[model samples]
Target: MRIGLYATGQAGLEGIVEDIAAAERLGLDSAFLPQLTAWDALTVAALAGPRVPRIGLGTAVVRTYAQHPLALAGQALTAQAATGGRLTLGIGPSHREIVEGGYGLSYDRPARHVREYLQALRPLLRGESTDFRGETLSVSGTVDVPGAEPPPVLVSALGPVLLGIAGELADGTVTVWAGPEVLGEYVVPKITDAAKRAGRPAPRVVASAMLSVTADPDRVRADIRGRFGTAGEFASYRRLLRQQGKAGLEDTVAAGDEDFVAATVARFAAAGVTDLLVSPVGTDEERERTLAFAARLR
Candidate 1:
């Protein structure tokens, strides 16, 4: 399985770029940038693309409700050209809280919205003009991006409907919070079967988790719960946690010393994860130690 790092939610671009460079130096496979309230993901990838040479670049996800598919396709193609065609465009319809509250857009029928969004997005990324029209979205144009081949597209699909869509159209799904049991029992089978029926290649499963190498597991769990408790309020995340038999985000975290952490990652690999994105959590020293050990995994 390929190992990578989540390179977002940090302080600044310079540091994130440096961290990605450091990860590449450590022989990690890729660096995934998140699209939150911070700097734009594609822009960061563009800036860091030339800086880090060997590692692949990805957006953990850029919310689809905010950006049009054609606009995002242009930016993604540019990033692909800048990065020497090492860009994975991950897109999703984010949670209702972010869609309605953050962007002031109506979060109505998100599944349909994403389905139609991909209907327009897939062809544009492949340098083909889109003349299709759907109920929720309609776009009739093409983006000309020279020297830009189609970059792989991954969808942030946690539930069944979205997973089906991702398996059929996109490269795969990028997940957070869902663990081995969820992946093996729910995610892998559904997506794989969908892809097979669609006559598409096997879909990728990029699983991300909050990881920490710590002697004091209780303290880390408590800290995670205190910091990210709001994640439980989201319906999708809450459902995922419930599937794992947890009520809070902290309980879903993978934490322990070297042996335990290694075993947890192994479980994910056995569950059919193609790429594992490690989101290190803890103090500076803890994070450094975690990265050092994770580098050894590569």
Candidate 2:
């Protein structure tokens, strides 16, 4: 499995570019920038592309509620060209709270919205025009980006319905808060079966987790809980945690010494993960230790 870093992009543009460059220096496969409240991930990737030449640049997820499919396709293709085709476009229908409360957009029938979004998006990414009409969206356009190949699209899917949709429509699924048990027993089989039914290739399983190589594992876990406890409360994440028999987000973390962390990562690889994105959590020294250990795994 390819191992990479999950960048929060809290660091400004230059910091983010430096982070990607450092990830490349460490031999990580990719640097996935999240679309949080800070800098725009696609724009950061486009700007960082020319700086960090080898490492892959991806959006852990860009919300689809606010942006139209046609518009996003153009931006993704432009980034793809700028990054020399080292871009993976990961998009999703964000949580209902975030969509309705934050974006002031309707979150009705997210599955249908994603279905319609992909139906129109896939064709445009391939430089083909799409004249489709669906309940949630209607699009008739094509995106043209010379010297840019279509980047693989992955959906941030957790539940069975969205997993099926991702399998049939997307290149893979990007999962967070799912442990090896959930991936092996639930996620991998569900998506793989759906892909087989759709006659698509094996789907990429990109698992994101908080990990640290620290002596005080308990402290790191507590810190993680303090920071990310609310994430476990999210409907989708709560469901995933339940599937894994985990109490909260901290329960999903892989923290300990080198041997323990390595064994945890091995479990993910054995569970059929195609890529593992490590979100290191700890003091600066411990985070660096975690990154160095993760690079050794590569």
Candidate 3:
């Protein structure tokens, strides 16, 4: 399995580039940047792409509602060109709370929204024109970046309908806050089956997990719960936790000593995860330890 480091991109732009460079130096396969209250992920990719020559760079996800397909496709192609085709465009219709409450955008029929979004976005990324008119979206245009290859696209999908849309329209799915049991029984099968039915290549299953290697697993789990309890309240995450027989976000954390942590990561691979993004959590010491350990996995 390909291993990636989840660089939150919480650091400033230059710091973010340094982080990716650091990951690449550690022999990691890729660096994934998240889009939340930080530098724009794609923009950062454009700036940092040339600096980190060997590693794959991707967005854990960029919110689909914020940018039109034409606009997003243009930016994605540009990033691909800058990165020499090392970009993976992960897009999602974020939660209703963030979309409706934060951005004041309609969060209606998200599955349909994403399906339509991909229908318009994918062709544009391939330097082809699109004339699409769906109930939720209507777009006509082409986005071209000279000498740029279309980057692979992934969707952040959890539920069945969205998974169907992801397998049908996108290259793969990137998942967060889900455990191995959920990946094996629900996520992998659904997406893979959809891809097979569509006569597409095997879909990539990229799972992101909170990673910590420590002598005290309980303390790390508590810290994860305290910091991320709100994720448990999100309906989509709640269902995923339940599928994994977890009551809350704390229960879903993969924290342990080195041997145990290694075993947990292997479980994800056994569950058919094509890529694993390890997000270092807890203190500065713990984060560094986790980063070093995950780097060694490469």
Candidate 4:
């Protein structure tokens, strides 16, 4: 497994920056930056880029409702240049609450929007002018991005339809809260089937989630509950988890021991996950434990 860490939502960018060097030193593969209220993904990527050497960088899921696809492609390509080409842009049309309620953006026809976005975005990244029209978007101008290499796009696809879309159009797919066992039985088959049908080369799958471990597993679970508390109180989170048979295990992070954590991560790799993202609680002791566990894996 290519093990890495999630920038704990509770940890500010500065805290994540503080941890990056240690993360790389411990030989964890990379760190995933999440887009949230207090932080922006691009800024975080820039600040942390020069600080960590050769450590992979990614956005767990940047909300697509905030910008046009062409614009997003330009931004990511520019950032990749700044990072000497070490950025992965993971994107999706975020949920209704953030898109509709928070951003006042329409959530209708999201899958169509994503398809349109990718169509325009891909050609633009390859230094070609684009004039494409789709149900959700239309662009008729040059969108050349100099010094921007083709960064692998990992789509946030949890269901069959989107998984098929990812296989057809993107380089990879990312899943969170979808356990590895579930992946083997469900997610992988859909993506592989789609890829085979499309005659595309094999695509990558990156799976991630919260997993806790400590001398006191109870305390670790409590920490997970506290960190993901907001997720628990929501109907959306419940529905998202239930959609994958993970509703009750939203607290899996809270109950896991080191063995549990390791086993969960191992399951993801065994299930063909190219990247396994681990969200450790944002505590010094917890971080230390995670690093130690990661070192043992190394």
lDDT of each: 0.90, 0.91, 0.89, 0.74
Clashing pairs in 3: none
Model 1 RMSD, rounded to 1 decimal: 1.0
After best superposition, candidate 3 residue 270: deviation in angstroms?
Answer: 0.5
Candidate 2 residue-wise lDDT, 232-277, digit = tens? 7778888777777889899888999899999999999999999999
Tell me how far the alpha carbon of residue 272 in candidate 2 is from the true structure, in angstroms, after superposition. Answer: 0.2
Error of 1 at 184 (Å): 1.2
State candidate 1's TM-score.
Answer: 0.98
Best-first order by lDDT: 2, 1, 3, 4
The top-ranked prediction according to lDDT is: 2
Greater-lDDT candidate between 3 and 4? 3
Task: Give the alpha carbon lDDT tens digit for every residue of 1-298 in model 3.
Answer: 9998888865677888998898888888998888886689999988889999999999989999999999999889989999998999999998888889889999989888999999989899888989999999899988868999999999999999989988988999999988887899899999999999888999999999888988777998898888779868887887787777788888877888888888888899999999999998777788888888987875
Off by over 4 Å in 2: none
Better of 2 and 3 by lDDT: 2
What C-alpha root-mean-square deviation, in Å, does candidate 3 show against the real structure? 1.2
Please give the lDDT score at residue 62 for candidate 3. Answer: 98
Worst 10 residues of 2 by lDDT: 7-16
lDDT of 4 by residue, 1-298 (tens): 6887777545566877877667777788888888767777866776788888688888878887787767777788877776778888888877777788899878887788887888887787777788998887787666556777867888888767788888888888887767776678878888888888888888888887765556666676665666566655444456656766654544545334677767766777789888887776535677677656855664
